[model samples]
Every structure is written in C-alpha cells, then in structure tokens.
Target: MRDPLTEKPRRKIPSRLIEVDAWIDSSLWRFGHGFSRFWESVTIFSRRFRARGLNKLAVEVACEGLTLGVAGLIVMLALAQPAMKLTANGLPQQTDYSVLFLDRHGNEIGRRGVMRADAIPIDEMPDHFIKAVLATEDRRFFEHWGIDFFGLARALSENARAGGVVQGGSTLTQQLAKNLFLSNERNIERKIKEAFIALWLESHYSKREILSMYLDRAYMGGGSFGAAAAAEFYFDKDIRDVSLAEGAMLAGLFKAPAKYAPHINLPAARARANEVLTNMVQGGFMTEGQVVAARRQPATAVDRSTTTSPDYFLDWAFGEVQKIAGDMPHRNFVARTSIDMGLQQLADESVEYHLRQFGKTYDVGEAAMVVLDDDGGVRAMVGGRDYGESQFNRATKALRQPGSSFKGYVYAAAMEAGFKPDDKISDAPITIGRWSPQNYGRSYAGTVTLQTAIAKSINTVPVRLSQKIGMDKVAALAKAMGVESNLRGDKTMALGTSEVTVLDQATGYACFAAGGMTSNRHGILQLFDTNGNLLWDSKRDMPPRRRVLSETASAEMNQMLSQIPIIGTARKAQLSMTRAAGKTGTTQGYRDGWFVGFTGNFTAAVWFGNDSFRPTNKVSGGGLPTMTWQRFMEAAHQGIELKPIPYIDNTMPERKAPKVAEEGDAPPPVRPASLTTAAQKVLAQIGMLMSSAPPLEKPEKLAAAAGDDNAVGRR
Candidate 1:
C-alpha cells in the first residue's frame, strides 16, 4: 500500500548518505558543536607572536587553562555523591510501657495498649532471619562501608539500559542511618548525608550490635515497633516461640506492612512468610524442620477477657492502683493484685441489681459497693450506684457522712474504754453547753444502754458517752484504728458530722474483719519481668494485728451491731447468712446513706448520695445501701470462709463512766434535782440503757453546759 516514492530511498544523496548519518550521531555532533563554539568564542587581533602586551608564552598559558577547565567538567560528572557525617545529641528513645488490670487469679482482666515489650528478646533471633532480611532489603548491609560504589555503578548502568533510575542500592546501615538521623527527602544530598552517617555508625558499633539495636528500635508495623513487639502482635508468642516461618513473616512486614498483613490476606502473608522461610533455610539460619513446625500451626491469639470493654471496675482499679502504687505503665511493672474477677463480676452485678430495686421502689438510679478480703485485700469494688450515669470511683473517693454507721465507731471506742453495753445513760434533755443531739426518731429513749444506743443508732447516747470518755480520746482512738479522719469536735460528731471517704471507712471496718490488725490498703504485690525475674517486690501488706481491736472489744461491738436487724437500724439486711455485722448510716437531711459491714472473711462498704447534695425523700441506708451491701457480700463471700466474730465477753458488770466535757472553757451537762436519782442511776448504769427506757421529766435546767467544740472528721 505504500507509495513507490516513499518506499524508494529518496535519491541516495549524492553517495555516502550513510556517511552523513554517521557524522550526525550524538557523539560526533557533540564534538562538532564544541569545536564550532570554540571557534565562535575565539578572538584574535594579529599573529600571537606579534602581540604588543602579551608574549607567546601568555597566549599558550591561557589556552592551557581553558583546556584544563573542560577536563574538570568531565571529571565532575563521573563522580558519585559521598556519605554523610555522624553527630550526637539525637532524639531520646521513644519508649512506652502499658498498664494492665489483673484479677486475683493472675488473669489479665483488662489492658491498655503499648504494653508490647513484655516478652521477646532481640538476641534470640535466628541468624538466617537476619540474613534473609538483609538480602531482601539491603544486601550490601555489611559489605558496604555505609555506601557501595560498585552497586551504584551497576544501578547507573541498569538505569542507563532502562532509561532512568528504577531501583536504589541503599544498605541496611544506610537505611538505619537515614531512618534514625536524616530527613526522608529523596535526593542526592539526602542520600549522601545518609551514607556518611551510616559509615560513622558502622565505625562505632559491631555488625551484630548494630543489627540488634536496629531490630530493637525499627518499626515493624501493626502499631508495634521493634522485633519483640512485632512478634507478639502477629503471633501472640514471644521471640523464643518464633520459628523460621514466623520469623520470616515478621521480617517480611518491615518493608511494607500495609501491602502484606496476615489479617488482611493470610495467603499473601503466608507466601511472603514462606519466601522468608526459604531464605532462612538456604542461608542456614534455621533448619527445614523448624520451618515446618512454625507452618504446622496458625498464629495464636491472646486470651479473651471480660475486662476487654471499658468498665466500672476496670476504670476504678486503674485509677486506684495508680493512687496507691504510683503512676506506672503496664510494662513498667508486673503487678499481682488482690482482686477476685469472679467476685468483682458478682459485685458489679449486685450493684446493678440493687440499683434496679431502687429504680422500682424509690424511682432512684444509683448505688456503690466495696468488698475486701478477710486480710484486708481489696477484692471487688463498684464505684457508682449506676455505672450508666458515671465512672467515678465512689468506693475510694466519695466523701460522705456515715450517718448511724458512725455510731459504731463511737460505741466501739466507748466500749473499749471500759463502758458496758448494759449500763444506762439518760437521754432526757441533757445538754453540755449549747448543743443537744437527737435520736433517729427525734424521740428520747431515756436510760439507753451503750449497746442498745449503737444498735438503734441512738444519736443522743454517743453524745452522752463522748461526754464521759472525752471526745478527744474518742477521736484519737478512731485515728489509731485506721479511721484516718479527724473525728468530729462538735456534739454532732456523735452523729457523724464529719466526712470520711468510702475507702478509709471500708478499710477501717476491715480492721475488725482482719482480726484487729491493720490492713494496709493496697493493690500491687510484685513486679517481675515477663521472664519471671524480680524487679520490685511490694511487701507493704498491712497485716491484721491487735491494731484491729481486742477480741473482746470487737466481739462486743459485733454482738451489739448484730442487734441492728432485730432491735436496731439495719433490719432490712436480714438475709440468710450465718455470721454478719453491719450498720446503716443516714446523714442529716438524708443527704447521704451508708451501709458498712463485715463478715469473718470480708468487709464491705456501700454509699448512696446525689451529686446535687439533695436529701433523698425518706431514703435511708436500710432501704437502698443495705440491698447493695447484702447482694455484694453474698457473692463476695461465696468461696470465702465465713465465721463468727471473735468471742467478745460482754458479761462483765456495766462499768460506770465519768461525765466528761471537752478541754478548755466548756461547761459540762447538768443533772437536774428532779431527775437526780434517775440521772445517777442511768449514769451509774450507763451501759444498761436501751430504747425501752421511759423518758424522764426535768425539774430545772442542766447544771454543767457543753463546750463549743469544732472537731470534725477530715482525712
């Protein structure tokens, strides 16, 4: 179809058409252009030997200089970019450790991310794994002194053949040098700088050491950096568990994890892993048998846990442990805690159940609980009455008045100081100075025994007893018993005018459950390496000692508190448990309700309060907190050994206490003439009083008045 004219050689241009083609080639044309430019740029006035101002030598020198300049230009194009120099003052290590929550059984209940370095060691990695890595990423990793001239030559030659630079020849050291020290700019300058620094690094560190550091610090994808972390993320196994295939899979991901993740495509991942395995086997880093073993099984996964989700218990424990143990990341320590996951779950459920009851009965939506082991180990904790509303740890942080429950402390102190539970104290209009404490019903139960007063949470009785034992000593006694709060100074302190956090209150009661010894409230027990090497061992366990209470003192307190259901305040907590002691508390205006109790093996405290600080409509500890406490204790005590309170002999004749008042200028309560016999008899038998006593009539005003005191419970 071509025209005859086009197909024909258009007139063989006079002969030697092929010679013209050869003359016009790039090399020949370049030389011809240079000659033409040289001739065009030349300037001559006359014969060089005839010049007036210049001699033949000067002319020759100028020509030689121009020729040298041309030669320099050719040499410049032939050289390569040189390496960079190393410098110190590099960035600090980007080290991070995570925090985890574990139960009493040593199971991880919950966790925070960034706890990856718990296992794995770089030194244990296979040699073949390293060689395979070097072959795939940077073959000249060891051969080059930070740069490879021959490789550059080969690259340039290949690029010339292909028409552009297609692949680079960066050594591993060069990459590390760039990754750790230089900007990721793709240019000759950056590459030169990378080369220099890599050479400096190789000069300072051995090949093995440098390789180890690189593996420990390099990014390995999946949100993990370093070989150990990569191993855990992909296989849920340590570096020790890594076989040839697993190691290959890990090594393969360093270049481009996004393009090859096991989760996204196991086949591609496995194929790449196999390639790595082949490299390892060929290189003699691992035997074919090891590779087979790794391939025999799929990657394992970490154990699933209930603490997986954000939860009230986890949140509370996370913060509480930090408070007690100091701020620590999960990797910073291997902590053994005292929590019972089962009991914690049970407590969480109970809190929900009890709060639901309030939702039905009182249309309320709140509850909280704290359970401790017999040894004072915090086992199960619930912060809010309703987790749906908030995540605040009311068990440890909430500061609320301990209504009638406060009465137990007062009575325990009084009974320990030699006051008998049967001795009567008159409640007939007795005033010390200006204050007058009232009973729960706002009615006087004249001549109530100390036991009955505490049993019924008789507010006036404690005030009268404080007058006998001196409230100062009572406060000291409470503080000594782990009631870390400053006791109330005013007469209302008898009615819990002071505030105490649920933590102290709960642990304070745990003193009794722990057999009168102090139970140091803490969570962390030991810190160890993932390999079981001891790092830090916490031996600050607060043991139960006589610091708890005299068995007799604790026993009498328990017996009297037991009457809380039969003859006193906490009648609602009469669940079918053999041995239990609890007291209900309701602050003034019902702003707060509390139920703190103890069994032989466990101590628990519960509180219900509104954020707005408004009084609940007829809400008492018995109604809501009791339900929560009972449920929590029921489950928290399931596997725990439940026994009776230590035997406290209460048969001693009632010891008469001296009428007392605060130090400094304060008047004492006066015994009226009309009520003298009744007052003395009641005062003489202050331990025999109860709600059954008849109210006495007063003839005149009191003789001694109370001192205006301002003591309050502050922890």
Candidate 2:
C-alpha cells in the first residue's frame, strides 16, 4: 500500500531510530582503529622479546619436551607389543584342562594340567596362611599400589648388604600380573610390561582378587599349580585344613619351587619355612611367641619317594588327550590311558637297574624304552632314568640314528620286490658313492642267504639290496609301516643312518606283530568328563588299521627277524617262555645302541645312549640294550599266556579280529557286526591248520637273486 506503484512514500520512521543507527556505525569504526593499533604494538613487543634469547631457550625446551614424550610413547608401545598381541579370551583363567590320569587298570597314577578347577576362594583360605605369605613375600602389600618405592629401596639396601639378591621388590599384584600374562624372562622389556600389566590388574581388580589370582596361578613343584593343589600334593590335605607350619612351607615355595619343593628337598623346604616364620615375626604380623611353635615344628611333606608317578607317560598321554578333545568346552577330564602300571614299574626298574649296573662300565648315562601291544596301544614308556632329574621324554621326543635295526625295512622292501628270505646275496665288501658299509666286526661273510646276512647283521647285504630295489621304496615302506620320523632316501639310510624315536621303532616293529597291518600308535584309550560322559574312545574315533605290507612280505620279514633272537646279534633278547622276533641296531662310534624286537603279545624298542651324544664304551645293540630288553620282557610276559609270533612256529591259537559290538549296545558303534557262523567256522579251520603246520626250515643253499653288477657302484 505504501509503494502504491510509482508514488512517493511518506516518512513513517521515528527520528530517534536514525540517530541510533548513526551512533552504532561511528562506534564500530573507532573500535576497528583501536584494535589495529594495539595488534601492531604487541607485534613490536614480541620481536624485542625474541631478541633477548630467553624466548629461544623456552622454544627449544618445549621442542625437546615434545620429542622426549614421543620417543617414550614409541618405546612403551614396543615394550607392550607382546601383551598387545595376546587375546583376552580367558584372561587370568587357565584354558588348559585339569587331567586326572588313570592307568590301564583304572587306578589313579598321577595328575596333570594347571588344576584351576580346584582353586579355593580367598575367603576360604586360612588367615594365618595369608599372613605367612604376605610377611614372607610382600609385607607392605596392602599399603602400596601396584608398585612400592619404599619396599624397592629397602630390598635394594638388603641386597647390597648381602652382596646378592636376598629379596624381591615386586608387590603381590605385580607377581600376579607377571604370572598371568608374561613369561619368566628376566629382561628390561619384560619388566616394563609386567609393571604396566600390574597397574592394569590393580585398576581392574581389588587387592583380595589380585591375591587370589596369584595363589591360583603360581606354579608349585611336583606338577602342581595353585596353593590348593600344592597343599594337597605336599601335605595330603586341603588348603583350609593346613596348619601354620604347613602354610609357611607352602608360602616358601613361591620364591623357588624346584629348589624348595618339600617332596624333593625336605631339609631345604624346612629351612625356608623357618625363614618364613622369622619374617612373620619381624613384619609384626605375628609375635615371637605366636611363631615359636611353627619355627620349632617344621612342616613335613608326605612321603612320595616310594610312589612311582610315571610322569613321563602321563605327560605324553596328556598331550594326546589335548589333541583328541582340545576343542571341547569342558576343561576337566578323567583320562583312561593305555599304560599298565605293572609293566611301567617293571620298565622303570629295568632301566634303572641296567643304568646302575652297566652304565658306568659302558659310560652310558641315558636310556629309553617304549612298549606297544599288537593293537598299537602303548603299554609302558621309560623316558629316562628318573622323571625328577629330567622330564624330556626320550621315548617320544628324541630322534637318534637307528643303525642296523633299520635293515628290516630295506629287507622288507626287497621281499616286496619278489625276493625271498632265503634268496642268496653276496656279503662281500661293497661300496656305493664312496660309502663302503662294513659289518659290525668289519669282516665279510662272502656269499650268504638273506636270513644269515640279517642274523649276523652284515652291512653290505642291505646296501646291495637297497641298490637293487631303490632307496625310495625302502623309505616309503618304512613310512607305511608307521615310522613317523623322517626317512632320508640316501644310500646310508639302508643302514639306518636316518634318525627316529623309540616310539617309531616300536611302531614299525609292531607292523610285523600285527601281520603287516598299520600300527596306529596311540597312548590314550578312553577319555571321559567329570560327569562320566565318554568324550573320546580311541577304538571308535581312531583311524582303522590298513594293510601297509603284503602278507607275503610281512611273513618273510618276520621269518628273517625271528632268526635274530635265536642266532643273530640280538641273542640276549630271547625270552624264556615265548618266541621273539626283532632286529638289532648299532650306530657308528657306538654313539647309539638299539634293540627293537617284538613278541606276539608286545613290541618294544630299547635305546641306550648318552643324552649329549657322547660315544659309549663299545656298547653294542647286542650288549646293554638287549640285556635290558630281556629283563623287561621276561617280567612283562609273566602270568600271561605267550602268543606265537606270526610266520614263526604257531603253538598258540591264532589271533582273531576284535568282535564288533552289535547295534543298540553302545553309542560308539564299532564295525558293522560280529562275524557270521560260516565265516567263524572257516576261520577256525584256518587257525587249526596254522597251529598244526610245521615251521619253514632254512635251506642249505639257494641261488643268488639276479641283479645289476653296477647297481651299487663305488665312486
């Protein structure tokens, strides 16, 4: 309406509004001028300040501080790299299963795993026991954070005065952090990570929680973990039921479990316990009168010397259980292993007796043995002289040269290539690629049968046979027979220059006992949960045995090997009541001596050597190893019917395949069903013929097996 097209509008605004707009514009212009003048003055003053050198010094200091902060951050990240890579799946909770091991007869032999399931709550622990640990390990644990500077200074002073490390400065929380997340490596990086993780644990858990974790996670001696397990292991009582003296001894083990383990060193453990009592008195945790009784009556551990643990066998069987049922959610297991405690005891005693009797004379320090049934179930394993002195399982872990014992595979390969056990071969000196394999006595037997050549352990026969049949075939045949160790396809492999474990020898020899079937070596027989649910049964889950060697080849090998105990290098390995078959192996320089043989009931491999690989004093496979084998086998065969080896004289009944369980009987169904009546009748007739059949007699002479003269040429 005011615009009204192009008509001029009348003035409707008040004069006061025009005056106010003019005033605001003048004020803004004056303010802009003042700010410009002030900025210029400040810039001039800053330039003057820079010229005085203090500003330069301040800037350099700030830059140095920034650089140091960045470097420290980089170092800290590097130190924490190990911790950062760890997954927070279970945190401080142990992921390993607590395994209670029982022998073949269902008798509890030992226990393995960390025993985290047996952890006792902090509130259930005795007050005096807590005071004992705190006084000996960390007196000011409750008063400090994760780290205590005053305690560290005092420890340093005490160490300086003693000229050695008399005390540890780490608080209980720090120890818990280390046990939970770090290895026992003594280095600066590990220490830094431990300190940082200690801070993290302190922030995440209370003092009681930290102490409880420490008590649960620390490793005590004799394969026990946590205070609860240690209490049961040492005193044969629960942690809450232990007296003050026993608690003091338990607390002393935290410093050095191996050194002060009551089961191992009672005197040293008592001395350490006395020290704990003194510490309790000096820390004001207990008065002299309160600790006097504990000091007087030192804790005594239960007698474990007479108790045979079979720790090495348990170690191996525990590993097998882990492999079979590792993915299961339940972590507490009761494993029924294939170990026979009677045979295990005999094996241990045999090894110890031999080592004590002839060890010094032969200058041999270590020996290992493995015994397996025809079904490939491990019966007994002697890893070393004593489990306490060393825990390395030589039976399952150590790999040494097999020597002449390996000739069985080479001969088996030859038999597979259509050569008979009585086939003639030249036993004269021969060489292959600058390698002249001589007999153990360095004497040649001229022309001889394969049976005689193996019986005497002539080196040149196998070399010639390997050259004719090819080394690859020999290696493959050995692998097929269940030699799990690596076999080199070389000329020397015919003489067992390749290395293998005692278990491998047993497995390979078991093939002969199994009538050429694969020996699926296994230690665990059945695994069960705490509630008695069967988690794994070896016969159900294990791979079925397949034919590795033809029946003819296996029969030939067994016939030839059976001659060894009767007239070969393994004469001492002959059992009193049962027939045995096996080959003897002696490495170069007498570094390793092995007698691996098998009865129809059991196959065993015995190795005698030094752990350092030092040469023994002329200890041949026929000597100490055979004697040990003889002693153990004689004891193992008592009170049981002796079965005849396959292909040898058959006086005993023939072995039949295990009867398969019928349907609706068990959850783990075996083969389809039992044999039919007609099939059983046919098998019975065959068994009668086998038992009544006469043994194959060795021929007086046989023609030489045709071969290329230049097949194994000397370089």
Show where candidate 1 strays beyond 4 Å. 1-97, 112-331, 360-363, 385-389, 485-488, 535-548, 648-715
On the 0 to 100 scale, the lDDT of residue 379 in model 2 is: 88
TM-score of each: 0.50, 0.65
Taken over the whole model, the C-alpha lDDT of each candidate is: 0.62, 0.81
RMSD of each: 30.5, 19.2
User: Tens digit of lDDT per residue, candidate 2, span 1-715?
Assistant: 4565545333435556788999999999889999999999999888865734787788889889999999999998787666665524536545466677777655567777664434688899999999999998888888887998899999999999999999889888888777777655457777887787777777777888889988887877776768988898899998999999999999998988878989889999999999999999899999999988888888899987755577788879878888888679867677778887777877887788778877888999999999998779998999887554455788988889999999989998999999997889898888777878788767887899999999999989999999999999999999999888988798989999999999999999999999899989898887866544567888899999999889999899888888787777887776657788898889999999999999989999999998878899988998888877877887777766577887778443232222222111422111123344366468746744664344222100000000111122100
What would the per-residue lDDT of candidate 1 be over residues 1-715, giving only the tens digit for each residue?
Answer: 7798875676566457777777679678899999987776563433434644466678788889999989977654343233322355443344354444455544555433243344244467765567668656666666777677777787688888999876566767776776576644356766757766777778877787667667766655443557776676667776666765666777777666645567555677777777776656665666788677666653432332222222455555545445444453324333456776666666777666655545545544455677777656677777765332333556666667777777777787787888777888877666677876666677887787777777777677788787788777767766766676656666677778788877777877776666566766655554433323334444533343556467677777777776675555675555454556778888888788888887666788888776556677666887677766765665554433446655533232222222212112322122111323245357535523432344222100010000001211100
Candidate 2 minimal-lDDT segment of 10 residues:
698-707
